[model samples]
Target: MNIENKIDELISLINYHNEKYYNQDAPEISDAEYDNLMKELIKLEEENPNLKRVDSPSNRVGGKALDKFDQIVHKIPMLSLSNAYSGQDLKDFDKRVRDMAGSDVEYVVEFKIDGLSVGITYNDGEFEKGATRGNGVVGEDISQNLMTVKSIPLRIKEDNEIVVRGEVYISKENFQKINEQQENLGLALYANPRNLAAGSLRQLDPKLTAKRPLDIFVFNLEYGQNLKFESHSESLEFLSDLGFSVSPSYKVFKSIDDVIEHIEYWTENRGNLDFEIDGMVIKVNNLKQRETMGYTAKSPRWAIAYKFPAEKKKTKILDIIVEVGRTGTITPTAVLEPVRLAGTSVSRATLHNEDYIREKDIRINDTVLVQKAGDIIPQVIEVVKEERNGEEIGFNMPNNCPVCFEPTVRLEGEAAVKCINMSCPAQIRRGIIHFVSRDAMNIDGLGESIITLLLNEKIIEDVSDLYSIKKEDVINLERMGDKSANNLIKSIKKSKENDLWRLINGLGIKFVGVKGAKILAKNFKDIDEIMNASEEELVNLEEFGGTMANSVVEFFKEDKNINVIEKLKKASVNTKTIEDKNSNVPKIFEGMKIVLTGTLPTLKRNDAKEMIEARGAKATSSVSKSTTFVLAGEEAGSKLTKANELGIKVVDEATFIELSSLSSKEEVESKLLL
Candidate 1:
């Protein structure tokens, strides 16, 4: 074969492997083998620049950084599917389709992945952009983040522009791992994998998105410039051939009975899959038939989704227990009589707190309704009062910390009863763990086990002691070799130079997160300055409220805290805030009150608010007549309705983005300033 022909063949082979690995989650070749192919492709492209293709698989790693996503107007609207709650609903949908398109009807059935729906656009087989299905007609651009999803292809061999729709999801395994990390870091647990997946997809940083184990399964060909396919199933096959990840278990059935059978099979066996699937999607297979049946403004009449209800089971609460968290907050848990739920044998479930138990009148020895929340966490849905016996005992929260025996107090506005001891063993261990975490000081070689060892061995009492550890001290510990010890010492030394916000966040002051810490650090110059500040001064910062300000003041007032700071200061740890060079940028949206609703095209809800705040605008939560503007996106829902009723000016996402970039607010102030 000629050099040009060889390059083409290599491209085809590489694309196939890319689809097999990224999309299908099955690799036919080893990593080394794939690397060798990529190596050859790069070498050939380098030697013969004329033969190189812009959309080649060689460019899959990454591309240019996107400051913000640009909006994309989908050529064909990505309509949602109407839902079918029961088997009868499915039959009715089939009848409607058959009545409109004749009895020669066929249906394509596939799993409806519980994830965010994204529209991926390809220009002449080159991967172009990926967007969320914002409002069917317009979607937020997330091309860079989508490119980070290994399951998504950067380029395809098919030389035609096409738009395909897929669900971007995280596997249950990955979700569990992420939650575990969050739990270890003293962070709030994610509600479910679906929410996590959506949040990960909308992340402003593609680098962060890449760390999430996101996958995609293409299910529809929304639009194809020059492509022709007779049926939906045919189009799926074509998409697969073109190096796209198509549905793993798609089947075409001529009879409604077959479609119903398929849905039933999946409903019973859904737990077997690695990813979460909320329901089964049944679509009319014939393209011409679909066109004839048409749409219903928001949803397609040609298709309907069957949603599976949450799985529930009954179990007895054997005992109630309280566990002290890192921050000393006590959480109540029910030790349940082992019951099988959603494929896993759950032995225990969280009762939340004393208030939850009291509200439900839950007692030990009472039978309760148990469910897998989001098919992940085991939680008590409610108490089964009818099954409760007189022998069941009422429960109450302890007056003292379970671990430290310290007097516990509940904050005025919060439900949690907290232990106030600064030197509580559990708190110290948790604090050290958080301090060395990725988002904090980021001591690479330090983990919970190592920190625990250090604590138990009396090598460290507080976070500052981490900076004082010698290599010899760690080398003698379990699993620590010479190289590991040296690395740990190096990482510890490196952490002293972290930004002041990290140190503030690592301190775990109540209500002071990364954002709040950054605000405090930026407002004040150093740790000593923050410690010396009054509640009034702390509350003056935008991110700080009265409660938060009080918490900071309280945290700093402790002798132990001051001692830790002194130790850190003596260790030469960085305590000074690094000033943002752009801090002096003109406040373009000054005095403007903006309310954002729904999901914006390219920006996450928080990202949009941050941008608005950066531009000297106040992003409020509610929409009223006083709202300078309501930035609306797809599924604007009640907020949009309220904005319209209140005579608040509403702008689409594109207009909002454009307005945000305006250098001056003079025109806006004249038109809509409050």
Candidate 2:
């Protein structure tokens, strides 16, 4: 074969094998064979630069950097597939497809791999670009990480322009292997494969991407040049021929029963597969037929994922215990006999509340069905009544604070048992921890470890004493140095000037959050006004529930808390609301929802929320159209995720600070009467 022909053959061979290696998880060829083919293509492209094409299998590693990256608008809006929870929902989807395309319509079904979705660009047979499926319009460029997937070809076999969409999944086996390695190396274990894939693919550098074991399966041929395929089935075949790992084993059905049968066939066998398959994606096979059907605001009209029922396993409840939260509410936890389910060893599950325990008749020594709730937290899904013994002991939520041994009480119509004592050691410590957290007052060098050190040393007993830390004592502490100590002192000093809402949140009062603090700050302007207000006064505030109103009133009524408030005043923590400020800064986001991301330049993120909310805006962690602004900074993660998804407006720190006009927003309210 000619050198050019060899390059073409290499691309075809790699994609063909990649489809097996990634999608099918079955490789007829050895890794050595795959490596040699890649080497041949790389050498050919290097020897003849003009012969190099963007879509060449060799280009999968990445492409040329741009002066400014332009967002590629998807030709067809990438829509999220609707989920079918039951067989009936699956039948409904089949019915809808039938109504649109008649009994003659063919459908394609693929494993809904629990992973990240991305779009890959191939120009003239070389992989040129890849990006996350961000809002289906603009995605973060992830060409580097996508290339690291051994299954994704650097180049394609066909000499044509193409943009194929696919899922990037970290196999459960690979995920466990990486986690075990991370644990051995003393790195934090990623929660699961999807989060790992997401974090890995979003990395800016390819060198880092090479570290993670990722795999890809091409499903949609987003764009095709010189490719003639009328139906999705035909397109998949052509793409497979060109060396892409298309989905396997989709059965064409004239009736819903066949589609239902296909889904039922996989549900039991899905577990037998090496990779995770949460659901089966059913879609119209014909491309033109899809266009005729159209779309909804979020999902496609033609496709739906029939999710497999959550896996449940019977496990014995060894005991029940209550864990005190930062707010001093004791939450019930079930200590279970260790059982392997849904990827990890399950030893404990949450009972949610006392009512949940009673409602389920859950008892110590009783075997129950435990499952990953929402595929995240482990919980007892149902009681295995057949196995229940009469000798089993019923479990009860604690009547006292687990940590402080103080009597607890649940309010009317509420399920949580709250530790009413403000100075309950658990309550105070947890509150102080929250106060110094990154989002709150954000005292640098004041993490849980440092707080433990401070508490053990008896250097600081309360949140007010946190402000009174001596630089010499802090520097002299073990595990801290002069430079770090100095920087920490500087950060702590900077934090003192933050708005009052940070103080309120850090206090860890029940029913008061960043948004709640803002409502109090804006309405009352000072803590004194809030303290003087009764439950009736609080209930009058917008969005303040009766329980929240009572909680606020009760929190302020305590003499010890009142004394702490006075101490906070003595330390000059910001207690004055900006509603009283004469600054001309217009609240661009009055009553609008806002999310904070990354580390801010000037204000702690929670402190920034305090600023935004002081102007009558509300702060939320998730972004939506209701979101007015996203304060973005270095390493912004989830809020950034939603901002990109919802197309929310984003701003830098200087702009946010400029918008707040709070150069002096930090000045303390006033020295309270002491």
Query: TM-scores across all candidates?
Result: 0.64, 0.76
The sequence of per-residue lDDT tens digits that candidate 1 reaches over residues 203-275 is 7777678778888899998888877889999899888988777988898899988888888888788878998
Best by TM-score: 2
Indicate which candidate wins on lDDT.
1
lDDT of 2 by residue, 1-674 (tens): 88788777887788789778866999998889888888888888999998875546665554343332234446555556667889888778877887887777777778888778888888867778777765455455666667767777776677788889898888778888998998998666777777788777765556566667778788888888877788888888887888777775656655667778878888767767767778888888888888889876556788887888887888899999887777778888999999756656679999998888888988888889999987779999788889865869977777778777888999999888788776787777788889988656878778777787888788888888887887887887876899988888888788878777777777767878766875687688778888889899889999877888898888888887898889988887777775556245455555667788774433566568667766656777778787777877544655665675686666656556655653342221111010
| TM-score of structure candidate 1 | 0.64
Number of residue pairs clashing in candidate 2, backbone atoms closer than 3 angstroms, sequence gap of 3 or more or interchain: 19
What C-alpha lDDT do the candidate models reach, one value each? Answer: 0.83, 0.75
